[model samples]
Every structure is written in structure tokens, then in C-alpha cells.
Target: MKIVEKKNFKYVDYLWDEAKAATLEGNEVDLLLYRSNLLGTDLRITNYGGGNTSCRTVEKDPLTGEETGIMWIKGSGGDIGSLTRSGLAGLYVDKLRALKKVYRGIEHEDEMVALFNHCIYDLDSKAPSIDTPLHGLLPFKHIDHLHPDALIAVAAAKDSRKVTREIWGDSMGWVPWQRPGFDLGLQIEKCLAENPGIRGIVLGSHGLFTWGDTAYECYINSLEVIEMASEYIEKKIAGNGGVVFGGEKIKSLEPGKRKSQAAAIAPLLRGLCSSEKRMIGHFTDADRVLQYINSNDLERLAPMGTSCPDHFLRTKIQPLILPLEAGADLSDTTKLLGKLEPAFEQYRAEYREYYESCKHDNSPAIRDSNPVVILWPGVGMFTFAKNKQTARVASEFYVNAINVMRGAEAISEYTSLPRQEAFDIEYWLLEEAKLQRMPKEKPLSRKVALVTGATGGIGKAIADKLVEEGANVVLTDLDAELLKEAEGTYGKDEVSAVVCNVTGAADVEGAFRQACLGFGGVDIIVHSAGLAISKPLEETTEKDWQLLQDVLVKGQFLLAQSGVDIMRKQGLGGDIVSIASKNGLVAGPNNVGYGTAKAAQQHMTRLLAAELGPDKIRVNTVNPDGVIVGSKIWEGAWAEGRARAYGITVEELPAHYAKRNLLHEIIRPEDIANGVYALLGILDKSTGNTINVDGGMANAFVR
Candidate 1:
């Protein structure tokens, strides 16, 4: 057994931990999982959910108490980095090998997938991935199929086989591009037979495959191959004399300027990309991304598309590039905005053409023609998807593609897969079947919501509910610490916290900007930030009245003003729900200041509804009678003033208010949240109408 010498790595990190491996000495499957985790977690090794690993282990057969060969491989749609034992599909090796005898050729390879289920060793294991043959048909005890950018650069080069020989000589084998299936697996097996003593094979315009007798040896083989490729590409890149991408036609914008520019145009780009369905966006101005988009060859190379199947699948066939001249003014948002729609439309038209030209008799209908990725010179790259994680992962994949192009172009002319081949993989019926198997999207899926006063009871409840329904939420409040605490309650991908004083114009604008950067843009706005000043007519000072108006009325106005601007730019209609008080309509005593502000908020909803009808922006109000439980207002002097006015103790406010309502039901913050959710999700058509969630307060009814 000849061991390959490990070279010192420069571009990729060597993360193998012998100490950790020792703990799983007896469990070969656990060791394989450990190796998979170390490889998958690093974007340099492979992308998210883009690679597969397998170990052929001897396990006791459940039917017969005898040891049998079982190949444990990554299941469908599982990310290797976060893969669990249950995520591995265990299939009988003998059965999998037997199916090869019945293989009917490349055209009938997809039928082989259904047979894989019959080979499952564990009835409860996850469904097998399409690339199972690439791992199962191999002779080695352990195998790895990865899509590292460095290796893919060599694989996607114009003279890929020649480059493979130059880099690894006869030590590594080379195979031509073949879509993943039984046929590709046979080609790999044949490559190994023809080239004895080869450590791995680079699949043309695809990825890399390596194998070993032991799990540890397979891990080392995979790392060594990637590291050597990285070293070779880096040397070639350096020899190019800093003239990669035809020598940077446009300089990168400064960090601050680029991000601000990204924030400025993200909503517009998001809107354009969301023509089919609403999308969440992820933006990146990383040096590598900026270098590619700002380069002279961007126009020439971007349209050729990515070579790897995993790469193009996430990014689409090509990205929509926003053309900007050298030394272009990024500050003139109007000019940048003007160029967006035309470019977007052209991209869509080209996508439709590609689909029409390449469709087969059984091809799935064309997917969204809207580009998943959009690149702007000097600014950066923007990727949109159904959710934040997918959007962010798409950006990461494009960056990987950029690195691949950089390496390939340095060594040789980069070559993408042929249009027909790319289209076949993109619209494969199996791929469509996988998509159909996906769980139904939640009601609020792809919608981004911004909730003001999010740290408060009603605000927090509304934010939580929105997230539960699949909406990414931006939680804003005046208190930074509370906002941080509130954000911690939800996953970072689902919620973002911004400290904002809604009364300040700059603060409101800045909050919206953060929301745009965080989750593309806002589709729903909830104005729940307010304070109460319950004072008798004589006792109410000018200061009290102004304070209430500023916090309640003025704050709601500022949020609406900023939110509407983003919604209009998105070209997607939006929802604005204000949490007003029943006092606004009831005109109760000792609540002059609070009642006046509430009335203003309620009327503002109606007025905005009438004005924003043309834009499809709905405005409504949720008037609560007495949300005394779990409410911040009840914790302050407002409770004391209300209690004094009602001639009752503060402790009795909940029971007293609940009894006064028609249903005698105490209103909780969640009840108010449900009202807001109903307005946004179910009663979407009803605008300028008040839905009184305060135990059916008759006085607050809209007549």
C-alpha cells in the first residue's frame, strides 16, 4: 500500500483531527461522518449540500444474523457538514452491484434510482441520492465525490484532460463529462481499470472523485488532490501578473460605498427577480466577487455560465450582470435603477430561449426565468431565493464559481458545459420529481416583514408568529439591549434586530435600509411601538399630549413613509397594520392624550388605504380594548391612571376590562398578534377596516 506524501496546503485548510477520530475507533460509519463533516463544513472543500461521501462497511444483516457489505452514503438534499447518522442511506452493496447487470443504457439510467430503494439495508433509512452509483459502484471501501472550486477549475478547463495530465501526470485518471448516473459510474470504473495505480479521477466539466481502502486513507487522498490543485492554480494565477479576468476594467468601490449602494438597489433588484414568486436576497461585496464583476471580461465570461452541475443549479444557467462603465457613479441610484429592468428582462428572455431550444419531449416545464444571481460592477453580487439561507447559499455558490473561473482562465481558457447538456441537467424530470417531494411552502414563505417596537409584548408576539409562518422578520425597537435579546430568541436567518427610534426620520430610514440588507425588503410592516398617557382633560398638559402624539402617531407615520417607499420599489403590494386602542373610538375619560393619539393612528390607516390603493399597499388597524396581560403599557403609569379613572386597583384592571368587553375575555398579546397575522394572511383583501381583537369591542367596530 503506497501512501501519497501530503503537501503543505496554502489555499485549503487541513482540518483532520486524529484525537477526535480516536474516539470513534470502532465505529467506521461515525469516522466516515467525521470525515464528511470536516470536508463539507469548509466552503473550499465542497459547497453546501453539493457533495457526497460513502463508506462500505460490514454490518449485521437484519434478516439473517450474518455480516454483509453495506454502503452508507449521503441521502438526498442533505448537507454533508451537518449530516446526521439518519441522513445516511444504507444500501446492500451486493444488491447495488447486481443492479448494474440489468442497466439498460444512459437513456434508462433514471429507472435505476427506483431500484436503489429495493437495495436499502435499513427500511427506515432516508431516500438515496441520485449520485449513489458514483459511490456504490466503486471498488474501494471508502469513496468521496466532491465539487471543490480548485479541482473544478482543472476539470472545467478547455483542455481539461491535458491539464489533468500536466498537473498529476498518470497518477490521477481523467474521465469526460457525463451526467451523474449509472453510466458515469461505469466510466469512472473503466477509467480506474485502464489506469492502474491512479489515486483519483477528475470528471470533465464536473467535479472530482477519489477513493481508498480505509476511511482515513480516503480522507487524505481527497485532501491531497484538492491541495495540489489549489497550489497549481495559485502558481498559475500568480504567473498571470495580476491580470486575471482580462485585467480589471473597473476598480472596486470602497467598502462603505459599495455596501450603501447594495442597500440602495437591493429592493429594486429583489422586485425584478420576484416576478414569479417573492424572494429573499443575500448580498456580497467580498473582494473576489468585486474583482470578477468589476473585470473587463465579466461580460465575456459571465454569460458562458458555470461548469459544475451544483454551481449552475443554484445560480441558474447564468447571472444577470448590470453593466456599468469604468469610474461610474454609484451614488446616482436613479441611473443604476434605470439600467436594472431592461437587463433583467433581457436575461429572462434569453433564459426562455435557452429553454425552448433545449426542451426534450419529456422535459419538465421551464422553471423561474428570473435570474437567481444579479451582479453589479463596483458594487457586488446579489442572490435571491425563497428564504434567507437559500439566498445566502446561492451567493456562496456563485463565489465558488468565480474562483473556479479565475483558476481556469489563468491556466487555460475556461469552458462551461454545452448548452444542451446544461439544460438537460437543469430541467431533468428527476430533478422536478425531487422538487415535487419538497414540503409545501408556508403561507408567509418568501415574504419579509419588519416589526416596529419588537421588544414589546405585542410586537414580539407578532414577530414570532410571522417567523412561524415562514416569514423572515426584522425586529426593531428603541432599546438596543432588548432588541439583541429579542433577536436571540429566533434563528439569525429568520430574524434581524435593529435599534430604531421610529420618531426620527434618519432612524426610520436607517432601519429600513438595514431591513433591506438583512432580508431583501419588507413586505409587511407592523407599527406597534407606542406609549400611553392617560390624563383627564384638565390634567393633560401640552407636554403629555405632544409625547403621546410623537410616540404613537408620529412614529407610525415615519415607519409607513419609509416602508411604503420600499414596497413601491419592490412593485409588490404590502400590508401595514397598526395596533391602535379602542379608546380611539370609545372616547373614555381620563384618556385624553392616549385616546387622541389612538384616533390619529386609526384614521391614518384609513387615509393611507385610500391613498395607497393604486400601489396595492393595504393599511388596516387592530384596535384592542384592554390588552392588560403581558403588555408593557400596563407596567407603567398608564395602568395607574386607567385604574384611577375606572375607580379600581391596578391589580383589578385585567378582570375589570375583560368584564367590560362584550365577550368578557381577557386579551393577551398573542391575541393582538393573531389579529395582525389574520389581516396579512387571510383578510388580505380587506383594507381600511378595523378588526377589533379586544374581546369583540362593539365600540371599535368599523360601521
Candidate 2:
């Protein structure tokens, strides 16, 4: 929210003019390059990555004047600092525009899985930016989107709309946040259908988005809208403005001094940059710059974090809050590094805790997080990279966030992201796909897996983990949450979680229909979902036996039945992970329905492996006895069931089970996920096989 300092404002306007002029001259490449650089400058005065700028070029058909209209989209993976023209992919404009016109359909579960794959393009990097088409929808050649901290402060607030409405009036349109891509594009197209010549859009609970016939016009419109918003809010607060003053009337350092400083700083870092050293400029004293230095509550006043989600390519997460106290020393660079080291540690720890709680595998360890870069207070930010490209990308984001923070305090506050959603986006499939496309260390990418009771716990884990390994996964469970969560991870494209009462004949038929839609056919289905109940012979009810039969017997037959059909169609073989207890292999006292059902489930798996050998699906079961964490088979259920047979307390159970396993290690859900991946990827050709994901418990089953 801080007003641009008169001096700094001039610098900003200068860069803006230079960028706009380039675009006005019909230099698309220069337009993009200029905006990218100006945007970097603007970001330094705000919070990290507080905003982004994009340009849409209308490429035409070779023979016709009509628009072939291919859009060279900013490929999703690269940061703007080092964003390369080569990374831009030509999107078929007609197809995307047509997609924008369609209404959202009530899609089938498996159908959604198929659709997610279709979203990819020949660029074959990560999925295209969900907003690529949205940007293309704008007729303007240039678009500027900002999460100006000041604007968001007033905007993200409950009454932000009133403030924005008061400021923007009929000048801009507003849209609510929806799932990005087709649905969102449809909504935007609907709105634009009515207001064809609109200039900008202010997304509710999001940020300011501006557009123009040219890049300069776009940048100016954005500045005008933001300035008006800032002025309106400043007056509404009943103050002329936050009164502030200049720095130590430090004699206007000569232009010669500016050149010397810019020269010194550029060379110090240029050796680390990728490509050749390009343009270099330095900011001298500016009015907003002074306001930024003198602004009160520097800590809380800064933009919350990012100006926009896309801004991550520029300003990272947070900025180094420089102390502008009178007589303060700006030369003490080490002090800035000292304050950051601890905060970085805390950030990594929180990140680790989040990873462990969500990651299905305990097998693959956490990555190093020493700090992507450092924020040096008065000196601005510096990136840490063995190479210049990454270091500069880090620096670009660092500055953008700072500028966003600078603007944010004026309006009120700009929200970054909610904690959980941040984690989801931070690890989103579109984000993860970049890693997936890279040559993997192991040859597991093409594996296909079938996981049962995949709607929850062990089954879901096995299913999702398989997808990360570059495998297509089929998950079966009666719960819809499995699909919801899985879709949240794999975008409903690479992973399918179906609701099937595995006990029913018709339902199993439906599950295979889903698999066909998911990956064209089936390769693996882990019969991981089943149930357990405990009671002595007299206490056990007939209802328990009936329920158990539906799952352990009938359900197995139906699921195996459908899978065989798909495997036959596929002709290529697959793997099946059946989760059975140690009691099924041998016997545990008082174990009635579960022991019998698992015994039946295993025999059926072997039976299918035998029957389907000609079609090529390998059927197997991971007989894990006591892997309690993250499986549908809850410890309480296992405890009560085990105690019924042994007459022991539930509290004494983990210990009791540990006594039976040879390795004395608890079977984690990750261990089960590992087993699922292993079974699918292993070269073993044998069918009707069993892998004991259990840590040596099968050896202890002497009976």
C-alpha cells in the first residue's frame, strides 16, 4: 500500500515506458523480455513474487489471414528470471477457445481420470498453466496480474469488494475463484461474452488483473487502477496519507556513483548467472522507496508473502525486513544472514513434518533444504546456486515478493495461501509432473497397479504411491473420499478411485468399466480393502459371517472377475496386491471371519492368476499381519479381533504382534506402498505369487 516514492516512482515509470514502447512497436519478443525485466524491478519493492505479467501473441495460419491463433504459452515449469522462449509451446487456439465455451459436465469418475491426461501437450513438461487459456481469452496483447500487498490487504479483507468497488466502480469486472482450466475458462468466457471490451478483472479474494491492446497500455492501466485503489483507501481511512519523510538528505549521489555501484554489483553476480550478462540498472532514492524505508511496523506491514501464485517464479516466499532506523548500519551484511538462518531451519522443519504426515512412503527419505537463497536486508536478496540460472531465478522471486509487500501494507494485507492448500499446491501433480517426466532412477514409471479398498488407508496409499512411480493405478473402495483425495493429488487423470462394494457382482463390473476409462485397460488391482471383526464362537453373530462373505468371498470373485476381462483386453500383463493377514496363512486363536475370508481371498487371487495366465495379469497378495498405520484395517479392529482370540488387552497388542514378527519392525503404510510398487515393477513373471510385505512375520507362522 505504500505509495511509490517520487524518485522511485520515476524509475518505475521509466521502466514501464520502456517496456510499453517496445510492445507498441510490435516487438513481441522484446515486449515479453521488457515486461519480464520491469516486472522484476517492480517486485523488489513488494513482497516476493507478489505479481506476474503475461503477453498473448496471435500467431496466424500460413495461408489465411484468419487467426490460426496458436498461443505460445509460458510453459508451466520455468521461473521468469530465466524463462526461455524455447519453453513456450504453441497451443491450438481454436481447441482451447472451444473448450472455454463448454459448460462443466457431471463427469464420471474414471472419465475424469482420462481427461486429466488429455490436458498435456507436446511441450511435455508439466501441465500447461491452468490460467493459460484464461490469459488467451483476453483480446489484449498484454496482461498484468498483481497481488499488490496493499490492494490485497483491502481486497482479501471481508469487505475488500466494497473497497475495490468504491475504487474501480464500473472500470473492471470481478470473478470468484473456481477450479482452474476448463470450468474457470467457461465462466470467464460467459462473463466476457457480455462485456467484450473490458479492460481488467479483479478476482474476488484473489488480486488485480489488468489488460491492454499493448504492453505499456496494460502496465499503465494496472498502475492507474492500483493507484486509484490506493488513493481511495487512503482517504477512506480518514488520513491525507501515512505522513513520511526522506532519507538523510544524503547528497543526491551523482549519476557517476550510480554507475559505479551498478557496475560493482553486476560483476559480483554476473559470473554466477546463466547465459550472458544482459541489462543492469540500479534504484536510487525514490519517493515510494523513502516511504518503504520509513513505513512503520515493517515486519507486519510487508505483503503477507507472495503477490500471486505464479509469482513464485520471481519472489520466493518471504523477504528480509530491513531496519531503516536512523543511523542504522546498512553495511553489516552478515547480520541479515544470521536472522535468516534460523527462520530457514524452522521453515524446513515444518516442511519435513508436513511431508512425513502426507508422504505414503517412509522408505524414500526427505530432501535437503539448506535454503534456496538468502535475503540480505539493505543489499536486497541474493540466490544460492552453483549455476547462474537458478541463482537469478531465485533473485527474481526475491525482489517480486518485496515489492508486493511494499504495496500490500497500503491497502491492508495480501493473503498468501492457507496452510494446507499451500502444501497441496506446493506438491500439486502439475508441479510434480515436471519430476515425473525426467528420466527416473528406476524403471518403474510405466507400471500399472490394482489396489482394492483403495478409497482408504492401505489401499489408497498403495494406489497413490504407485502413480508417483509413473504407474497407472486402479483403486477400489466403497468410499468416495478416496477419489476426492486422489483426484486432489493426481488431477483425476493418472489415478482412479472407484466406489465399489467389492462384495457385489454388478458393482465389480462397474469397477472394471472405470479401469477401462482410466488407463485404456487394467494392469494391477491390489485387493487391499477388506474387513475384520472379533468375537469368541458363541459371541460371533451370523451377521458377521454374512458381511465377511460379501467381502472375503463374493467381493473377491466380482473384483477378480472384472479385472480378468480388462487384463484380457489389455493383453499386456499386470500386478495385483492382495492384503491378507498372517492369520490367513496359519491361524490365530478366536480369529473367525477375517481368517476364513483372507484364506478365501488368497485362494481366489491364486485362482485368477492361474486362469488369467494366458492373458498376462500377475495376481499376488502382500500378506502383512500388523502394519497398522494408514491402512483401512484399524489397529482397534485388529486389537479387538486379536484379543478375542488371545484374551489380551488392546494396549498390549502392538507389543504382542511385534513378538510374532521376525524383524520386530512395525509394518508402515509406506512399507505397504513400497510392497505395492515392488510387486508391480519387479521382473518376476510367476502368477499366483505372494510377497510378504510383512517384515518377516510369515517366517514366524510355524503352524
Candidate 3:
């Protein structure tokens, strides 16, 4: 429970040096950056973008030697771990603090936002954190505000005041739950004025605020406070068996079984969670998460409230407890999918009622009523968000809350702010306004897509375009190594790669299942997997024809059928774009196998379009010509053979082919990708049609 000394910490020197180099004029800004980064680097202290830090420093006018006191604080929506000079915004200290004196109660959100922005030292600087005024009113030179999990255990407890005294012994001041804004700032300033002896403040059901003359002191204070709270909980919960109440001991969810269940159930939940505004679900069977969600009293204890009020902004007040049996139906995907919608509907109805009960005339617009965090029996838990990072962020905080609640309950009964307070924090002007600051989502922001042959030129280009248009992609390819590389390029969340042999039913089905697991369900399918062969009628080998038919023809058929099944289960009409070739429309010597397979694939697209049109599913094709760049198919033997057939060297193939076309431009993979994207969703009413991407080849103009 002791503070980590500066000499004992290994990274302190490197961090301090880095902070000093980033400072403007090498002042206390170095201290602000150093201390803030130290606090942020530890997930035990604060999660991503969850806390704020500030310093009261002198801003020297370079032109005039006049020194003005300016408050430099963490800017809104900036992460503290990678914070730099730009992450810290400077505001006129007097102007910020003067609001305490001149403020009449301004209850409107816009008016308060305007007032805060007006106090900035310069409009050009990044916007100050909403908690800027709280730091300004405090007399300390340096301030650290953090939402440490251990602190939440104590601050969110029913006997928070008693626990606060037991942990810090009057060293910290206590304030009841108040949503973060001007009123909260005034209340904090009042608490400090009332308790002049306290060095820090414990915000009930919120976070901790500590300050010092030196940066090291403020940082150490937070560490020491957190360590003490952590120790207190550890001791209280020492040798505690699973909560045994009324002579019934909570059973353990066997780790091995829980993990298997989580993997099996995740895909179904993912598919169920998918909607018009797409959400990606992530599965976790972390020991802490399982221990809590599977506990005997979860039905009574879990839904009380969040571990802290601040978390309500991210995780809502409580998680949706999915009605999943512990052992039965754990591995049944169809059963889980069948039950998912009803469970979600019930959760939504209850959430809406909760909102209605607590809302006032001036409440902000309600966010998604669906619970972001879902907990089940042996399946552990799932978190759904717009993307993986956000889902992970929520999961991390939720895990922290679980540990905090475990500690609080071990000590005594765990409790948080009442419904009204929780509602206030959720709809508070400053917190709600953060949503408005987020960048606008693209049209396909919540949609998911699955693409075959995604490691190759046209396939990879199509995947990238879909991502740029705001769709989450599931990429399938025959080359496992190449698919892995492609997956790494777009980060963990945007694209997932599955090694798939499209001609094999098992592989195709597995690929579709993976698409469901990765992004709930596939809304758009681009079947780009194909093979080409060069052989004249006389030289054509049966083996060459079989290979072409297997990959170019059979592959499309398998992928289209599997993807359509997923779309049908989702009950959302989807787009299926087949990447047929320009060769399909035009006959050429030594290209019989390829041209024939492609022609059959195009015909299959038409059949699929006619069959699925009744179900509102659209089918289309993109016929791309000689795309040489990023094409492994054209770079080796195929390049030499095509060049030889055209009576030219391989080096002249690109320009020679380009000139034969009306536009005289060499078609790139991106050109084919654009056509594919247009067919997928952009051309909403267009289906059973081929969009040629051949730079204007009249012979390949769908004749």
C-alpha cells in the first residue's frame, strides 16, 4: 500500500526526459506531461480517455516580458498515455476561475459549452478538457484526476464515507455523486474550502482528484491512494470462498468449459447483435469476468448499478443478463441465435423503461437502448461496440468494475448512485456533448462484408475500398500466409482473414461462420476468387479445365450459397457481387478454360439474382480486364504467355494492352474494386448486371 518512489520506478527517467523535450520553454508543462503519462500508462489507474490532468503554470508573452497565469490541462477527447504538447490546452486561469464568481445558474448545455470555450487563452489551441474549471479553482500547482478501479471499489460502496476514512484517515475529502460540469466544479471547490486539511478528494461514485506543488507528489499520491484501497479489499476478501448465502455455495464455471462455450456462443451473439447500424462483438472469458457473472448472487447483485457513475457513460447502468443456461445450449449456435432477438428485445424494453422513468423535459437524446455489455452463464460475457477498440475499452472498464464490485461486496454490500444520479451522469451536458465531437460515421459504418480471394489484387483492393467506405470486412483466401499479411495491414478490427478453399464445402461454410464471428453477419458478399488457364482447343488439357472450373466456377457457386444463407438468417437483404472477367464476354485463342468458367460464373450470378430477388437480395457482377498491377497471376508465366500470344515482349504488355482499349489506360486493381463497390450497395436498384471495368474494350462490352 506504499507509494512507488521515483527512484524505484524504472521508466520515470525516460518519461521525464521525453516530457522535457516536448515542453514549450521547458517549464512545468514537462511535469504535466510526465505525471499524466505515468498515470495513464497504468491500466489499473485509468482507462483510455477516462481521466484528465492539469497544471497551473505561467505563460510568458514572448513579445512582452509579461507573465500571465494560464491553466494547461489535458484536452477533451485526447488519450493521456500518448499525450504530447499539443494534447495540453492552455486557458487563461483568471478567466476560467472568474466563472465561479459571475456564474448565475446556466442549466442549458449549449450555453455552458459556449461559456467554457470563451475562457480559452486562444481559440486556435485544442479545446480544454470539460473538467478544466475544476483544476482552475483548486489552489494546487499540479492536479491529477483518475478513475482508478481500486478507488471505485471504495467510492462506490454503500458505506463510502466510512471506507474513505478507513483507507485514508481524513487525508481525503468526500463529495457525493455529482455529474461532471460547472456545478460539480463549484461543489469540489466548496469541499476544499470547507476541509482545508485534506490533500485530495474522493468523488463518490466518480473518481479521485489529487494535487501537489510537484508533479511527482501528485502522481505518487494517486498511486498510494489506489494501493491502499486495493490492499483494503484484498485483506477483506482474503480466503473468501464463492459467495455462499442461504447455505448454497456458488459453483465454479470450469475454465476450459467456459472458454469453449464462449467461442461457440460468440458468433450467434454477434449475428444477433447486428442491425442497420452495425456492431462488432468481442468475447472474453477472463477469470475475473467469469467469476463475477457466474456467481450465485449475480441476479441480485449485478444489476444494482455500474461500479462508478463515470462508467455509466460507457457501459450503461447495468449489463443485459442473457438468459442462457449454464451447461445446456452453450454450444448450440442455432438455439442461441433463435433466443437472441427475444432476449435483446426484452433488454431494450427494460432499458427504455429505465430511461423514461428518469428522464426530464431537458434530457438529451437517448443513446442506443441495447446494452453494450452482455453477460450469460457459462458463456462468460460479450461486449458490442462500433469497432474492436471501443468494445475492448468497454470490456476493460467492465472488468475493472467487476473487480471493484468483488472487493466492495467482500467488505460489505456494494452499492452505487441511485437511478436519478445515474441518469444525470449519462445525460449530463458535458458528457453527452462528447458524442457530438466524434467524427461522422460513413454510410456503411455499421455494415459487415465478406470477400473471397481477398489476398489477391482485385480482392484486396475491393476489401480496402469497402473499409474506406466504413464497412467491416471478413477476408477469405486460399493463401494462408498472404491472408495473414493482409489481415495485419488493416489492424485487428477492420479486417479478419480466414484461409478458405472456396471449392470445398467445409472451407466455405467455415469461412462464413468466421465472418459471422468477426462481424455478427455478412451484409455484402464479393465472390472474387477465380483461376485462369491458357490453352487452345487442340492443346487444352482436361486437368486445366477442371482446375479452372473448380476455382472460377464452383468457388463462386459455393461462396454465394453460403453467404446467402447467412444473409437470410440475418433477415436483412444483402448484396452479392461476383468478380467475373472481361474474357467471359469476348473469345480469345488459348483462353478457353478461363473464358468458359467465367461465362458460367456470370450466368450463375444471373440465376442467383432471379432466385434471391424475391427475398430482396441483389446479385451483380464486375467484369475487369487486364489489371497488371498487384496481380501475381499476370506477373509470372501468365504474363509471358499473354505477351507471346499478343506478339510482344512481357515488358510491353501493359502499354500494348492499354492502347488496344478505347481509353488507352491500363486497368488497375482499384478500377475493378470501384466497380465491385458500386454493384455491392451503391447501385441499390441495379442487379443481375455486369459493370465492365476494362477501360472501354468494345469487344468485352457485355455483347
Q: Can you write out model 3's per-residue Cα lDDT over 1-703, one digit (the tens) per residue?
A: 1223443332122233433434534468876887787778877788788889988878775546789888888888887777888887888888788876666664643355467677777556677766877788888888888888878778888899888988888789999877677777888899999989797999887888988776766776667677778777777766475452111324545867665555556555655565434576666777677677766767887688685755766777788888767676544456666677788888778888988999989799777777788888655678888876777778888887786677678767788678888887788766667778799987677678889889888889999999988888989998888988898889657888888998899998888777655555678888888666666778788988898899888888888887777677666678889999888899887788889998998999899999999877999989888888777678676787688778889889889879999999999999988897777657889879999998999988775
Tens digits of per-residue lDDT, candidate 2, 1-703, equal 1113323332234355543454446656456656555554554223333344566566655556566555544555543434456644455555655553343562321123224334333344334555565665655567665655445545454455565666777666667644345555456666666666666666654566777766666656766666666555556444525432212233223444432332233222212221122111112233343344344443453434553454442333444332232333323434533543455556556657766665543223444433343332232333443222334445554444444444443445445554444444455555455546755333444344566777667776776677776665666667687566665666433565667787777777666655543333455667776778866668778898889878777776777776665454333555665777666787656767767888887788788788777766777777777766665566566567666566678666667767767878777777877776676776567678776766686553423
Best by lDDT: 1
Location of the lowest summed lDDT over 10 successive residues in candidate 1: 324-333
Tens-digit lDDT track of model 1 for 442-549: 999999999988999889999999999999998999999999899999985898888898889999999899888878888999999988888889999999988889
Best by TM-score: 1
Q: Model 3 TM-score?
A: 0.90
Worst 10-residue lDDT window, candidate 2: 273-282
Error of 2 at 70 (Å): 25
Candidate 3 off by > 4 Å: 1-27, 61-65, 105-111, 239-276, 326-338, 430-432, 478-481
> Against the hidden true structure, what lDDT does model 1 obtain?
0.89
Task: Give per-model TM-scores.
Answer: 0.96, 0.42, 0.90
After best superposition, candidate 3 residue 360: deviation in angstroms?
1.3
How big is the positional error of residue 333 in model 3, measured in Å on the Cα after superposition?
A: 8.0
